[model samples]
Target: MKELLILVVVTIFTLATYYLVEPFAHSQMHKHVESEHFAYNDLPKLTATGDATRGAELVMGGAGCTGCHSIDVAGMPAPMDAVTAAASYGVNPPDLSNAGAVYDAKFLAELIKNPAHALLVEHKFDMDKGQMHPMVAFYGTGGDLDQEVADMVAYLQSIAVKPEELTPAIAYETVCGRCHANHYAKWTQIGTTPTFKYEKESLAFQIQVLEYQDSLVKYMGTLPPDLSIYIRSRGEHYIETFMENPQNYLKGTAMPRVGVNKHAAEQVIEYLKDSGDAKRHEREEVGKYVMIFMVIFAIFAILWKKQVWRDLH
Candidate 1:
């Protein structure tokens, strides 16, 4: 009866500490920034409904998105090759094939209108120092900017593969693949490339990676860390909050508020876990059995001690 009472007290203490004290301490240490603190929250609400057809024409021709980015759908093949595009812009422009599926619509419109503001890196752009973001702001050709942006978004959405069909690779590519590489997953900063069979292909890939890295350093003033082990290093909570608003975590960080919604963020975290901690599930499964064994052994040990001391008592 005494042992049962002690166990109940200990369990209650642990639960109370975990549910109450830990949270209070953590909140005190880290000021909890709400999701509304994200830069995308400041973007004006879109007024015009997007027209996919008009957006397509604008993207391909008037908006000149193909000059930097590749849509990969029917009419909108990449105009410039990856190397040329990377040379022209500091980084290889992401393929817009999944932009609609991956990014928030308002965020995309803001990205088109003001790349620096959309990316939460306006501080890095200084006209005096000649430091500018690689992606230029879209000033549409004397047209209704809102409608044009809406149309472009609609066109991107139209070309997007269904969200349900998006694999981890696709999700990561659209979100983090531009700035970060996952070597463990064989995903490069540019895109996923199959292992090269030929030496020349391998060498070419290395050169491309180097060029991209160099450009990134110039653009951001620092190389973004490889995300291969970030899940293990930083843990999920840090990554999620950092992605939501990097400025909150690291003030004046060149990294942008990625504006990844919770669903997509969860998918990204799952992908990171799969890559960095492949054995986590197996380890957890084994741990459960070990815990059971320990509990059984402890119970038997207590019973044996009671039996041995019965005479003395």
Candidate 2:
């Protein structure tokens, strides 16, 4: 009788702990991001219609974006390699290949107007020196800022790659691998390693790409975290929300607002769900049986105890 009572108390305590502590534990991970949330539908609409063709012209022209970034569209040639660009700038600028698919148009326009303002980055000016780490305002397209931004946004959307089918692994490699190299490398080691799509590239060029990736830590101040366990550490909603507007989620974080649309975000999240917990389905199935066994065992134990104590009573 005493043992059964102890078991009951233990089970209750465990359930209480899980119900109470789980929420607090989850909240701590997102404490930095907590704010009065607003629906995205409430935001203001864009003023101008985007034009991809003209946007490509701006991207290639003296807006000087190409000077910093590397675009790999079919006709566009990267003027400078990734390594050279990262060496020149403190960080490797993001690839704009998927900009159309990833970013919000209004967000892109705001960023172009002022990078620091878009990011909400604080700046302290020194009397001896001018503004430090200031991104040059892009007023290209003959100084018509509105038209320039509109064209850029249009171009980004136009150039977005659409695939009939995208696997979780493919999404991770193409979208998330650039920054999360460690996670990619680890995942590759565990699973069947994927063949490089650029296998036809010259050996020297491949070497240069590898070297550039290795040197990213030098420029990025710290290597961005591996995403191997990111899905587990940060839940799907947190990841999706963060990708949408990093500044809103984690103030002062260096993670720029990515241009991923809802569909793309879902794809990445689906992939994460699989990659992060390979045994999730199996565990859930096992849990049901375990609970049933425990219940049956408890009943049997109680019946036996009652039988043993009836004589004493």
Candidate 3:
């Protein structure tokens, strides 16, 4: 009876403590909720049917997407590379290589019309009167706005990359891809792709990641190191430490604290290790059996010679 009373008292105390501090704890999480106005569930829907061909035309001609952005589709030429674009616009525009696969059509449409509206916080418009915003409202004057937006959305969707769902590769791209383009390109050449084991996948989620990465690059003058062989080069512990706090590894480095949690870092690290050393686990497995067989053969040979030479001995 006393034990039962004690258990009940503990349960009541836990519940009371939770209820008392819940509001304050929730308030503390406010800043973590990137956008105050928009959320995944609350994102507006795109009603118009998108047309890829029309969207391509809009991008090339009326939309002027090539002015700052670039897509490597067959004949389309980008106006400038990342470095040049950054110089001209203050922010490097992302390639639309997998934009279709990484962004929601509705969100894309909204972003085209108003970049800051889709973000968690309202951008400071007073910083620079006319030139600060990288992307201005692009409702095409030559074409119907809805149809143009739909076509652009359709074009992006049509060119979506494989493994469309979020994966470790996508995480790397969003978090580490831009600055480490050479590493990413090398991985792609070697046919390495991101794997999604624990995290959920979505284009909208990827767009948020791309946006975050871009913001970091703009703030920091230098691009971060390529992480393609980071596991092999720096080892997992170093990767984890550097990722957790870059300054710990290199003093006065431009690399910002990415705030990647343990689980996310593990996922990125696993992807890097797997991509860089794909045959490591396989080789280890085969080596064990080979060693076992060699030992067995040595023992058998010794026994056979001993038996055959017993009379001579």
Ten-residue stretch with the least lDDT total in model 1: 32-41
lDDT score, residue 179, model 1?
Answer: 84
lDDT of 1 at 300: 100
Over 4 Å off, model 1: 1-32, 36-39, 126-132, 198-201
50-164 per-residue lDDT for model 3 (tens digits): 8899888887778788777777753556686544565556446766765665454566777676664543213333225542355666867576788788889888778755442
TM-score between model 1 and native: 0.84
* TM-scores of all candidate predictions against the true structure: 0.84, 0.66, 0.49
Go through the candidates in order and give each one's C-alpha lDDT: 0.82, 0.63, 0.61
Root-mean-square deviation of each candidate, in angstroms? 3.5, 5.9, 15.2
Q: Could you tell me which 10 consecutive residues in candidate 2 have the lowest summed lDDT?
A: 34-43
| Candidate number of the best lDDT | 1
**lDDT of model 2, residue 287:** 100
Report clashes for each candidate as comma-separated counts: 0, 4, 4
**Highest-scoring model, TM-score:** 1
